[model samples]
Target chain A: MTDVTCFSADCNKSKLFWGLLALGGLVMLSTLSAYFYIEHHGHIVTGMNNQIVWGLPHVFAVFLIVAASGVLNVASIGSVFGKKIYKTRSPLSGLLALTILAGGLAVLVLDLGRSDRIIVAMTHYNFKSIFALNMIFYTGFFAIVGLYLLTLMDRKLKPWSHPVGFLAFLWRLALTTATGSIFGFLVARAGYNSALYAPMFIIYSFAYGLACFLVVQTAMYKWNNIQIDEYVLGRIKNLLAVFVAASLYFTAVLHLTNMYFAKQWDFERFILVEGDTYPMIFWLGQVIVGGIIPLLMIFSPGAAKSPARILIAALLVIVGGHAQMYVTIVGVQAFPLAIFPGYAETSSFFDGVVHPYSPSTLEVMLALGGMATTFLLTTVAVRILKFLPIDKLDQKH
Target chain B: MTASHKPERRDFLKTGAVVAGAAIAPGVLFYGIAQGRAPEEGASSLVRWGMLIDTGKCANGCTACVNACNTENGLSGKTGPQDSQWIRKLNIKHLQTGIEHNLPMLCQHCANPPCVDVCPTGASMKRADGIVLVDRHICIGCRYCMMACPYKARSFVHEPLADQNPDVPRGKGCVEACTFCVQRVDKDQQPACVEACNADGHQAMLFGDLRNPESAIAKAMLAYASVEVRGDLGLNTGVRYQGI
Candidate 1:
């Protein structure tokens, strides 16, 4: 085991830090521009309609939101699970979680019909609605994680870190559960309406959060020119593989269960084979490239020793997670709701037909803005705060 | 005695005129209220407004109800994928038997509305009188209501609205569905669709208070079996259909 120290001082001023901040700012500006354009011209100028209400923006928002919870797993491992290596990195983990959540929420709020009346959402309460419950859970995550971060960073309050960390861990799990249930509880759709989404989302969070952590950890180390111990990287890579496998397993179960029911035959066929882009995304984007390939790379012989291979796996997992969300959010809506059991129906509203959706330029910009928000905040946070752990590498692996 | 009789006759005529004026004034005022005034503030749960459509009476080529709803609700009736349609005429054909049917579909207005239950801000709500509506003041336009609705009854306002009926205010970015023309209902009149259908002589759509045992709709419901669309979900919808 290596002895670790904490860095309380501001990070050394570097061109790299300024460059990332500048890029983040540019993306955020474009996002704001898109928001204003949509706000002024209305959704009529965009591709979204009555049928496919939730579109590309939702996919990005949910991805960040789910990833935010998963990102905290590192801190949970450190504080709740009592791992020495993870414990030192708890502050950074907490910070990343908070920032990423903020980004996701920004996209969700801006995409609303009355973005100006956000206060109404804050004041109103429908206790039975899962969406309302999610509002509460989301706000609680920030407050709880904020406290956990303080407890970890403040030397005098360090003793309380364990308890605070435990609370944050439980809160995130609940938060992710609520997020998943947003789709699962949708009894109207054929694709969603299953309890499996809750656990599936949790497993997804694990994979996504670990992958994100690896990327950030690698970046910080490379920027500082510090030699990361091969042992540390190996542990994280192995854990990512396990999480990815678990996510794939849950997906299999969900499809298998759907296959068992004859009623789901049409929906399954649409998603698996007949759908326009949905089948391609499900098979190519989600299953093979995103899931199987990443798993193979992670479990390949001597793969853990190479940081590059692990990073590649992390990137693939992220891509796959996004594809999975696209299928879940957009593809589900694209498939028409089954109103009549045995009748072929037609109407002016594109009923009984697959609704086509392609992301607009504005939507893409808005989504990228959410990503930029996370990046900018994370950079500013790490530079000012004592987020990076001081690593003491051992020569012998 | 003759002079007294004359005065008495005159007095009787004046009293009769006064009584006639008093009786007619209320009817005129009610007509005015029906034309322009808003619904009274409180809607009671005692009155469950519902619709029962007799498919046997619905004509295949008739779109009078759809047109009436658009005009009443200030919708364009453009039939674009994104245009607001408070009501639509659906043509359904049985896959196995080759049997065909046509019906008008709108908000089921369930006793347990999924849209209301799923609305994040309580914007999609059912009034005490069982009229489901979106509280536009709070609807963040998330479109979750649209997703939750079994009937593709709801529409999201994609474009800024102009020339809207002052009583029916619509703006961009909010999800809206048929309000059962609560304005007309409050004034003790049938919905615009029902009126138009009756006017067109189709007489397929019947509107009345379901709770009142004596109501025409309730009586008709008793006479013939009515089925709620997707009734197996057990939402207990306020709207019902016959001869499906």
Candidate 2:
């Protein structure tokens, strides 16, 4: 590893930094404008109808919330497990977690039909609801992360940071589980009514969060001309391989479990084998390209040590994880359970019986805005604050 | 140092005790508040709003109930199957026996309602009288209740609504279902659909106080064996179908 001086003021001088901030700000304004317009007029502005009550915004919101959990992995590794390699990067990881949380919240607010009544969600708590529990966990997690970051800034408060870090790790795990239970506890809806969703989310959080963190870290290192140790990068590649394998296994088990039960076979087959939109996403996008291809790239001896090849695998894992979330949440609802079987099965796809949905252009723009917000916040923190410890490399074990 | 440290240790213990007490205080206060407001105990005064659907007499093709509900509730034009089905006519056939039955289905208003159980915001709740209504003002549009409902009775207002009946107070980001015409019931009038059913001379749909023995639904329940959908779940649903 080559030693590089802290770019005292150069962090603020990057062209990408300014560009991302401007783009992020513009996106936020546009999303806010759309939200207010819809609020005043009603939900008629969106494409969602009765059968497909949840559409693109719901999918994106859940995706962002899940991704937010993943963004905390590096911090958990460094602070909770006391990993030396990750120590310098802990604050950056915290910043990522915070930014992702904000993005997640924004997507949720925008998805609501009454955006102004969001406060009602807080005031009215249904103790029986896993979704309500998740809201509470989300709030607590944010508060804890804020406190942890503040504690890190004061050298005198360092001794107390470990407990805070431990709590953050435990809280994040709980938060992710709660998010999973939001869907898992739905016993009525065939696609989502399962216990598997909870643990599956936690596993993907580790895989996706680590991949996202590495992408940003690698990009930053390149921009600053900082050299990363071959040993560290090698370890990360190995970790990525394990995460990708686990994620693939979780997904396979979910499908297999549903198939094993003959009664559930109709809905399972409809979504996995027969459905038009679902089969392509489940097989090509999520399973083969997202899972098998990435698994091969990471585990194959020929490609294992190559940094550039490993990054591609990581990217695939992120894309696959995201696609999985969409299919799991949105695709399952596409197949309508007919209350009456004797009547001719109404072809909902052709007839307007089923609501047709594809994200409107503005919905896509809002989702991109969420990602840009994450990037811009992280960039500003790295530039203006001592988020990454510049002196950690020089310290002896 | 020992003498001074003794007072410091006592002070530390006191501080620790106070902090622990503070943490536990909120839980205790919440419990007390819940208990204090507990309703007067007697034979349950809660109105148990229920419906009795006579499948034997239901005219399969006559969509009078659907139209009547749409007109009375001020719902927009019927767009999709799932959006607005306060009363849906279904042709059910048992796969094993090939038994066919034409049934009109709506919110069953279960005593142990799954929708109410899963609502994160308590927006979906059974009134003391057993009518399951969603408080639209409080819903965050999370849609957990929609997934929990066994009959798929709930619908989400995904797009903004216009031309809403000012009395109804519809909003987006909330789950809604048939309230058995709660406003009409409160006014001591029959549900609009029920009125429409009677006016069409079908007499297939019946509404009454389940608690009153002389009511038509109660008399019908006694005369004929009434059936509830998915009765195995034991939700004690208010809506019962006769001769299904």
Candidate number of the best DockQ:
1
Q: lDDT tens digits, residues A1-397, model 1?
A: 9954535333444556787899899999999999999999898767788888988899999999999999999999989988877887788889989998999999998898789989999999898999999999999999999999989988899999999999999999999999999999888789999999999999999999888888888788777776677778777788998999999999999999999999898999999999989999998988997899998998888886788888899999999989999999999899988888788888887878899998899999888877888999999998877788664453222
TM-score of chain B of 2: 0.78
Per-residue lDDT for B32-133 in model 2, tens only? Answer: 766643445312334566788888788767777877877787766464643555556666656667766666667898989988888877878888778889
Supply the DockQ value of model 2.
0.24
Regions of candidate 2 where Cα sits further than 4 Å from its true position: A1-12, A301-305, A338-356, A389-397, B1-46, B81-83, B95-99, B158-167, B172-174
Candidate 1 colliding pairs: A113-B140
Query: Residues A47-124, candidate 2, lDDT per residue (tens digit)?
Result: 655556666766666766777787787777778888877766778778888888777777777767666777888888
The regions of model 1 sitting more than 4 angstroms off are A1-13, A392-397, B1-41
Going through the candidates in order, their DockQ values are 0.69, 0.24
